[model samples]
Every structure is written in structure tokens, then in C-alpha cells.
Target: ARLFRSWKPQLALHAETSGKNAIVVTAAADLDGAVRDIVKSAFGHAGQKCSAASLAIVEASVYDDERFLERLADAVRSVRVGDSTDLDTTMGPLIAPASGNLLRAFTTLDDGESWLVEPNQIGDCLWTPGVKLGVQPNSWFHFAECFGPVLGLMRADDLEQAITLQNATLFGLTAGLQSLDPVEIARWTDRVEAGNLYVNRPITGAIVRRQPFGGWKRSVMGPAAKAGGPNYVLTMGRWTDSFPNCATSSTSEVDENAQFKEYATAWAEHFAVEHDPSGLAAESNVFRYVPLYRPVIVLVGEGANRDDVERCRLAAKVAGVTMIVSRDDEADLLERLLTIRPSKVRVLGTTSDAIYARCDELGIPVDDTPVTSVGRLELLHWTREQAVSETRHRYGNVRVRR
Candidate 1:
């Protein structure tokens, strides 16, 4: 309270989080009633905080609800405006005289609409009655976020449009919606991108202890705001480890019927020889590898040697490499190659011949180094080693290998 008092004439108190999250205040009720509650609660704090509702979107259905609007207007009018020290005072004076000027600016906007609550005076503080009524969507009053006792009301065409306008603001800290329809309410609660999605409640009533609070977009900065749940703590830790020779081994048996299976077996055999891991023996026909920081190499070729190509693809997959192939080179391998731009190309048999011819046509130098047919043991060691290295680097020393 002392800090708030010292900061005289506050224009806005925007909530910010250390993390990249947003706080959304949704009022699932009548718009006028919802705005009334927000004004009452916020002014209760002397309108010195960011959680206060500076602008409100009233649903079109209830825009003209006279009874509701009357009650809302009465609530704002009832605020006891006086000195901060007064026990009966529901709102205190502007921290300084200049704050009165800022509050007046918001209250005096000539957007072709009348003020529901005109600014008044209580001692040195500038007091403004709360507002609840019809306003334009693009009204300057609707967009301005006055920290004091001021609320702008605009009608949304539908619930969906209401949510969209609510989220449309760059300030995504808090929003409120009012509706009794459970399905409509649930849909808004889920689709609304605000950090907090409340149902049938006031936007200012967010519980700090039980509910983690923060804003998204410009409203928030870092990640330190505590979110509800214990799992949030794990988001702050880091780990690391190393694998010596996990890829050298031998190839396993082939299942002639499974296309991917043959590929998996061949790849396992290739990497196993480069890195020797006892685990390879059990899963020689499986393609297992984790992604690393390095760009992946995907191979796309004809199905002439589908079995051999599959094996190579499996090997690449296990090594954290990407591979792509066309149904056949005749369909346009150049286009596919242009799309992939692999760091290295592994061509075999007929596919190799087709690629070499294309490379000549495109004026790309083709390396004729004899294709080394690696045994399972050699391929295994290399695959495991690369996978382990990639895991270590990509995760910033977080040990992924068991």
C-alpha cells in the first residue's frame, strides 16, 4: 500500500511474469454485472494495480439489460471516496494531483458517447464514478487502460466474436465473459488463449495461491511466475551424460515380408559395426535414434532396392538423420533433392546411377567414391556414438542416454 501511495497518479499497473505466459480474466456472466464486480474489487485496492479491469467487452445480448445496468451503475456510485486512512473510505485520493489529470484524460474522451460516471473530487484525490453502458468497439475509451475507476463497455456480436475481441488486445493479462450455457462457456474457456480462463466469475477474483498468474505477449516478460502444480519446478533443471561406443555391432536377421523391417535391419547392421553396443543384438531390426542439433539428411529414391534403401533409412533415422525418397526418380528427383538439400547423399545401385546422371545434368560434382557396404557391427558403433553425441549437444548436456 505504501508503494502504491508513493507512486502518485498511476496510469496503468500491468502485470508481468518472468516466463512466457499470459493471464486472462473471463467473466462468465452478464456484462454489466461482471464490470460492476471488477470495478468494485479493483477500486477496493484504490485502482492502483494491474489486475483491475480498465476495459470490458459487454455481450450484445445483455447490452440493453436495464435492471442489470442499473445495479452495476449503483455499485460504482456507492464507492466511499475519501482519504486512504478513513476506515469507511472504499477509495482513496489520487496518489498525487497529476494522477487526477491522467484519470481525467480517460474520462473526458469525446468518442461521441456520454460518460456513465463523470470524474469528481474527494479532498486532494480525483474520484471518478464507475461506468457501465453502450460504447463503440473502436472507441478511444475502449482501448485506453486507465488504472483508476474507469470502465469502457463495448458489445460483441456473438460469444465467439466476444472472445476474439477480448483476446484481440495486445494486453492479454486479464479478461472476463458472462454466460450460463455450459457448452458455450466450456468452448470459450478452452479456446480463449489467456493464461487464466474463468467461468461464472469476476476477472479480478483470481486466487494467487491456488492459481498461478501471469500475462502473455507484451504483458509478460520472463518465466518465474509460479503456475499451479508441482511439475512446474522440473522446468528449471538441467542434466547431462555420455555414451562411449554404443553404435558398433552386427546386422540382425531380415523379415523378407516387411519393407520397413528390412530397412531397419540393414541400418542396424551398418551402425552396429561403427559403434558396438550389446543392446544392438536384441534390437538389430529396429530403427532407434534421437534427434540432435545437427541438420538431418533424408534420402528419397526409387523402390528398386526397397529393402536396402529401407535399411539405410532406418540407419539414418537411428543416427538422428532425416531421409526422404520419391516413389521413383522419373517423377522428379531433382525437385525432391532441392527440397531436402541433404548434407550428404547415400546412393546405392540403380538409385545411385539415376542420382549421378541428374547431378551431371545439374552441373553438380558427383563423388564416385565406392559405396562402402558397412557390416552390422561397424554401422552399430557409429550410429550409437552419433546418437549419443547429438542427444548430449541438443539438450545442452541433458543426459538422454541411459
Candidate 2:
């Protein structure tokens, strides 16, 4: 009561003692009246403590409730605004002019979209009216923490979006949801990220004594820095006087350099496995096929010879090679081969010399008889000779043995 009496000059005589703390009463409403009464007695000792009501999310159904708004407006108008020396004053100047400037800047963003009461109209001192209203959602104005008598309003498409937007802000200091639906209120109360969440009541009307007060995000700083809690202190004590080799201690020992070396070795080994074809062959237990720089042409009997084409395709897929098939009309096949531009062509059943003469005229290199039937030894030799001649013609400087 002594604390209340001391600050009563600046805050009117609405101060009360409810529990451990002193509280200064400002505005009271039906739903949050008990909580506000408790809050008044809790922080009442702080002379300059101005509990500003920041936001009020009225349900869409209450849009035409002029009586409710009028009552709120009347309560705001009735606030005694004056200097600390005035006994009848319910509000006083802010701690600093910078605070006043911040509040002014915030209110101005509403432009003509919202209503902002002039600070001077409310009191000769720095008491600004405790409420502001807007008809629509202004993204610029919706998200902020105005410490003083500044508030913003935004309409949601539905109750869900309203709850979503409420929890979207990084600041989770305190929040209030007003709804008659028990399930709806429960859903909001459970999901809202605020440290102090209230249902169907004003956020500003938090009981300081019964409920611990604190803010989240940038609103708070340092350890145990939450509002309305015991201020914390750090201390140190000496447990050991003897000097020891702390570096050799098992708990303190570290091998960061060795760990880094081990990681580097493992990474290098993994890289080698990924890039090396021989490693892949060893792992898969398959014959490693080496690819030529140029494409390969394989002469098959006909298009219906699916077995040979399948073999060629499998080999091409494995070795990353291209296979060109030759048909009966050699001219058409040569034209198709020109399209393919293969480096090596394996001719089946054709002699090397005859294939060489054809390739010489066409300016192509031939690799003769890479694979042939068991009884085609004579054909393979003849094909090899043709390949040698074709290679010599393709590179005139190189020699070919018959």
C-alpha cells in the first residue's frame, strides 16, 4: 500500500495490493476483470509502469458491437494523464523521448486506413491513448511490438488464418485469443507460440503475481532476463588449489588433428573408388570394357536378327560405345555409317582386303572380324588384312603389313 501511495500521484488512486507485487489499474473489462485486478496489485509499486493494451482481435460477429467499442473508448478517455507530480493523473511521461518517437512512427503507418489519437489530446504529459483500430490487414502495420499506447488491427479471412497470423510473428512474448467456441479456443491456445497465452481475454491483463511475466525474441536479453521473475546473479567458487596437467586429463584430451587426418584419408579413398573403372570392375566382378574415342560399327545380317542387335546394344551400353549396323545395300549402309561416323567397323564374313578397298574409297577406318563363327578362321584373317589396309589409307603416313 505504501508503494501504491508513493506512485498514486502519477497513476490516479486505482493502485491496489493483491499478492506479493504492486499493480496499477488502468482499464478493466468483464472477461479479464479478475486478472486485471490481480495485475494491478502486482506491479503497482513501479511509479512509471504504464501497462499499455497493445492489440485486440474482435471476432467478426462482433463487428457491429458499437456499445463494446464505445465502452472501451470511454475507458480510454477517462484515463488521468499528467506528470508524476499530479495526484489525479493516471498516466505519466514515457521514460524517454525516443520511446515517444518510436510510438509516433508506428502509429503514422496507418495513414488514413486506421485511427490514431493524438498524444497531446489525451494529456499535457506523454500519455497517448491506449488503442488504435484498422478495418483491413496492413502487413506493414500488423507485425510489431509497440511498448507504449499503440495498437494495430487486422481482419482475417477466417478464424484459422487469424490464429496462423497471430503465431507467425517471431515475437512470442504474449498473446490473447477471444472466441466463444471451446474447441476453437482450445486449438488456438494449444498452437499459439506465445510464452503467456490467454483465451477470451485481453493480453495486457496478465496477473503479475500468480503468473510469471516474460517476453520472447528481441524483447528480452541476457540470462534469466524474463519480466516479473527473480533477477539472477552469477557467482564463482574455487574447488581445487593444486595445479595439475589439465591437458593430460582423460576427459579433457582431444585429437582434433588426428580426426581430421583420418577423415581426409577416408575421403580420398572414396574418391578413388568412385573415379576408377578398375575399382568398379573389381567390385562388380565383370569384365572391364575399354571404350574407343570413336564410334564402332558392327555388320549384322538383318534387322530381324534381334539376338545380334541385343548383343551389340548390351556391349555398347556397357562400354559407353555406339554400334552401327550394315544392311545389304552397301551404299545405303555407307550413308548411314557416314551419319554415325564410327571409328571402327567389324565386318562379318567379308574378307579384310575387300573391306579395306571399300573403306579406302569412303575414307573410313575398319576393324575387321572382331567376333566371328567358329569355322570362319579364313574369313577372319581376310577381314584382318582389310582392316590393316583401311587403317593405312585413313592415315597415309602409317604402314600396314599384308
Candidate 3:
């Protein structure tokens, strides 16, 4: 209770695992590189990390190509799963004795699923990586977050089918697409909904800030201020203009809409920016905003001005999001949360700050960006942040295949 009253930051981090994977579009592309990257991304860390590539939706032609299959199997088989301290060990064992979703994946197969490379339990907590082919759409393996060293392979007639299969899960933390064709890469990246998108590279092991991590749909629980990104600590501190910048615009107009419009030009671009933070010639990193699947629920005080409500509506519109505005003398945010289950919750005016702490415990994200503030930070509350990383150069030379 004292901490709540104190002006201290409440930092949070969600470490729970989710189903994340990649789609290898092997059309007019580097087959050997794809196998190398897929094997590494899917089996790395024994598929224990949330961002590990648990599924691979390969284009039908590539899935059937013997060269691709033989190479993938060879790569999987060569991995030496043993003691983590061993220099020769490629990956470590499961965190504990596998149970639940992961155990089922290791021990059983769905109706239409069959093992391409069967798993061999080599230790109490270690099992040889397994790959399941013929993973039917919407099957148990398709959506389950089986946090183990098991990879599910699905055959897609075309890129469209591959993307559909990739997005069939509720989670969208990290997804990758492998293709040598720039046209296919552009088309797939534009449509794929994920927190992180990688092209021609391993999907796991994201670099800090450059690949700011968090996902939409059910992948994230809290406000998803990405771990190493600019907005990570935003909520924990209150906004203050003690040392004001003359260059920055100060929103002070009595008319909310007019004030918002004054800074409207900078709204979207300010909150998110696409840049190669690494400045690496071999890689391209794009950090952008992706709208959340659910609406943000905004609670306003009974005495809230009409202009304030209008500003909220305009902000959501500009951010390309929908919102539910609840104006009541006593806002029932908890009740509404039970009913609507919004992607996030924010309150403006006399609403008790205590609710924010409560929501945090429930794993429901809370947006503390000042409602009256305009420009830079508002959009972060309305949209999910995504970092798209692509390996543009192969072996330090310009990739010619794409």
C-alpha cells in the first residue's frame, strides 16, 4: 500500500512461453541456406524459448523436393543434444521432465500427423529433436505451444496457404519467411501479423532494441512495452515537463481536437520509426506499429469534458484502432474488463490509480500515457510494436538470389 502511494516505478516483464514459429517459402530461393536456418531456429535452445520456431510451413514444391528434405533431416540428426556445459553440445535438455502440451507432442501424434524424424529420448530431461510432417490445419500441433524440441512441418500449395497456416495460431510473437524472391518476400511480410518478422535468417535470438519483442493477439499479456525498446519504462514513471524543450510543441489548447490536430502530423511517425539501429550493411531492421486485435477500453470520469472524449476517439482513429469509451461517475473498469476483455485499459481523470496495479497483477496491460498529452507516446498505447529484421547480405556480400 505504501509503494502504491509512493512515486516509484512498477516495472514488469512477462516470461511465459507462447507458440511461435516460421514459414519457409522455398520458391526460387537458397535451399541449403533455408535448411541451415530452419534447423537452427526451430531446434535451437531445444525449442524451449517462446520465440523458437516450433512450426515450419514449407511451400509444397520445396517440401516435396528430396534435396530440401534430405538436408533438413541431416541437419536435425547432426545436432548433439547433451550437457549444456559441453563444448560440443549444440543444444540443452528440456527445462524439466516434459509434460502437458510438450509431452504429448513428444509421445503422440494427431490423426493426420506423422513423424518425419522420430524423437529418441537420450536422457531424463533430453530428447532428440523430432519433426512431424503432414500436420493438418487446425490440428493439435498446429496451435499448441508445445515448448519442446519438436518441429511441426506443414505443406502449403502456395505462399497464401503457407501464410494461412502460419497465422492459424492465437500467438504471433515471432514469425519468419524464407524466400529468395523479393516479390514474394514483400507480399508475405506485408500480410504476416507478428511482433518480429525475419527474412532469410534464423527466427530466434533477437537483438535488443533492434528487434524489440512483444506480440499481438494472445501472445502478450501486459501493456507489452517491449523489453529493451524506448517505451519499456514509460508506464512506471509519470510524465513531467520539468526541463521543457522549446523545440517540442506543448499541448495547451482548450479545444482538445484543435490541440490534437496541431500535433497530428507527428502522431504516427513519432511513436514508431523504422531504422537500422545496428547500421549493419548485411541486415535491415524495421520497427513499426501493428494494431492490436482487440479494442482498448478507455474509462473517463463523469466530469470529463466532451472535448477530452473526442480527443480519445480521434487518437484511436489516427492509430488505426477501435476503442470503447466508458464515462461514468464511478467507472466499473473491473466489470467491463470481465465482459469485454480488452487488449488494454486506461483511465483519464479521477479514476483511481489503484486499478492500474490490480490490472497489472491480472496480466492486463495498462496504458499510463497521460491522456491530455499529445504526439509521441500516445500511439504506443493503441498499437502493438513490431520489429522486422531481415538478413540482406549473405556472408558479408550482397545477396544475389533475391
TM-score: which candidate is best? 3
CA lDDT scores, all candidates in order:
0.45, 0.38, 0.74
Candidate 1 on 117-218: residue-level lDDT in tens?
Answer: 665655555565556345565555555555666665666766777777666665556544456455665576545544444443445544433334554434
The reply for model 1, stretches above 4 Å from the true place, is 1-36, 98-101, 132-134, 224-402
1 versus 3: better lDDT goes to: 3
* Residues 13-65 of candidate 3: C-alpha lDDT, one tens digit per residue: 34423655766665766888888888888888998888888888888888888
Candidate that beats the other on lDDT, 1 or 2, i.e. the better one: 1
Question: Which sequence of candidate numbers ranks them by lDDT, best first?
Answer: 3, 1, 2
lDDT of 1 at 6: 29
Candidate with top lDDT is 3
Candidate achieving higher TM-score, 1 or 2: 1
**Lowest summed-lDDT stretch of 10 residues in model 3?**
1-10
- Of 2 and 3, the candidate ahead on TM-score is 3
Query: Deviation in angstroms for 340 in model 3?
Result: 8.0
lDDT score for residue 322 of model 1: 57
For model 2, residues 326-358, the per-residue Cα lDDT tens digits are 654666665666576555565544433444445
Displacement of the residue 216 alpha carbon in candidate 1, Å: 1.6
